[model samples]
Target: MHSFSTAVLALAASATVVLGHGHIRRVVVAGQTYPGFERWANTDQSNDVTWSFTTDNEGPIEAANVNTADIICHQNAKNAPKSVPVAAGSSLQVVRFNTQGGFEHPGPEMHYLASCGDSGCANVEKTSLRFFKIYEKGLVKGGMADDPDWNMQKWATTEVHKNVQPEGEGFIDTYTVHIPADIKPGNYVLRHEVMGLHRAHLGEAEFYPQCVNLEISGSGSQQPNGVNPMEMYHASDPGVALDIWVDLESYKIPGPAVSSVASKRDIESSPTLKTHARDIKHWLSKFMA
Candidate 1:
């Protein structure tokens, strides 16, 4: 049980060998950029203690610390009290940064959501937080030649995973996810993360997680049935200590599966919805052409 301070000190001591790390700069909702850790920590209130430390201390959590308190949000930034208001069901984009170069880590990307108590964002407990998958992306093979399109469908019905280009280039990366329309209106935490398996062959997996606080407002009333956040993964879990070079197909994304209250019964009841969705895509393609 490594304390947050212990993890920070260890990370600082080995800062020289830390491959790369970054945080969510800001979240875009309805095309509006809201102040997140990066914005608040860099502004006139840069001296604010909660967010300031993140500017220099942002990075990946060691694979073995997945169960530590720091696992809640990278480096246990629990005191960084900041939350942005958003409408339920609104389109949301989490903007991420790739420290050294482009996103060179090859593995799946994922997003999870959890609710906080009425005591407000400031009093939310990280261990009490339970999350259900909202989005995930894994490898998708297209044609026989080299690379294939990995872009997912507009909205989501389950957890997803996608592949990161081994030779991609860029400092900034963006991933899209939506607030469950039926989600209860309240405060929540959006955990945006990526698991880099490049060094997994050596039994080391790197997790880059950035958490954003959000106050959602809408007519929705359903709550997510999620798993205990702390128990989501274990240090010795196959997914956490993996060998990406071998057994690629056997790899499974960590944490509980996505369970959208609104979509479950509907998707299950209307079998033709899948066909209709496919038809809509086909028609849209023809219309665009």
Candidate 2:
């Protein structure tokens, strides 16, 4: 399972509203959480549970000196490194996306929403698009092959990223939700929703989910720090260098590729590889064009 770790901050409000696909199709999308309501109790609570990740950046990367990020997180099961466990008062794993501030001011803030959306349930918390992609697209497999819906993300974050985080300005965001004195203890999925726009009327700017998970217990169940809980983020861009062999070489692609094969080096630089540097340049040029 892919996970992240960070400490808890204070909780103030619950993020609200629905994604307004305009159609309430019961397509079973997971990881969409909002404040006030959460779909509590895992009646089935499948231990058969498995986790996967996807990000804008899914490749070999160094932890310093870069900014253009990949945000994508499918560190494959084999590719995923074993990290410390998440518990109350320890460094918890949280996957977050930086709001480019392309949208309007006071956008949706980032929060560690519990496991359900209001429409989805009364006791559950909000979920994330990252998690949704996992459900809808299936574990981002096959050597950095891009998910078709990866395109949907452009519509949400791109516009808002303009005003807030901009090319240089540091992004400011807020997350909503509390563990509630009654929240059950155990490993639960949490989202790190980040935003700058607040006006619900200006489209769905306030509802995007840039999130991660948590294993809450003890003090973790208490109210979090209102904002900025000592977070350290990494660019999701795959172009950055790294130390791990797979991370440094095999971008975040999972499984094998098309009816073909090659040496490890060849696999790392295949024709289909989603090289982040190339992706950024191509995308930038296309935008400029």
Top candidate (TM-score): 1
Predicted structure 1, TM vs. truth: 0.69
Off by over 4 Å in 1: 1-20, 39-42, 45-57, 142-170, 262-289
Worst lDDT run of 10 residues, candidate 1, spans: 141-150
Instruction: Give all TM-scores, in the order shown.
Output: 0.69, 0.25
Please identify model 2 stretches exceeding 4 Å from their true place.
1-104, 107-178, 194-206, 219-289
Q: What lDDT tens digits, residue by residue, belong to model 1 across residues 221-255?
A: 88867777667877677667754332122345677
Error of 2 at 73 (Å): 11
lDDT of each: 0.58, 0.25
* Every candidate's CA RMSD: 11.5, 19.8
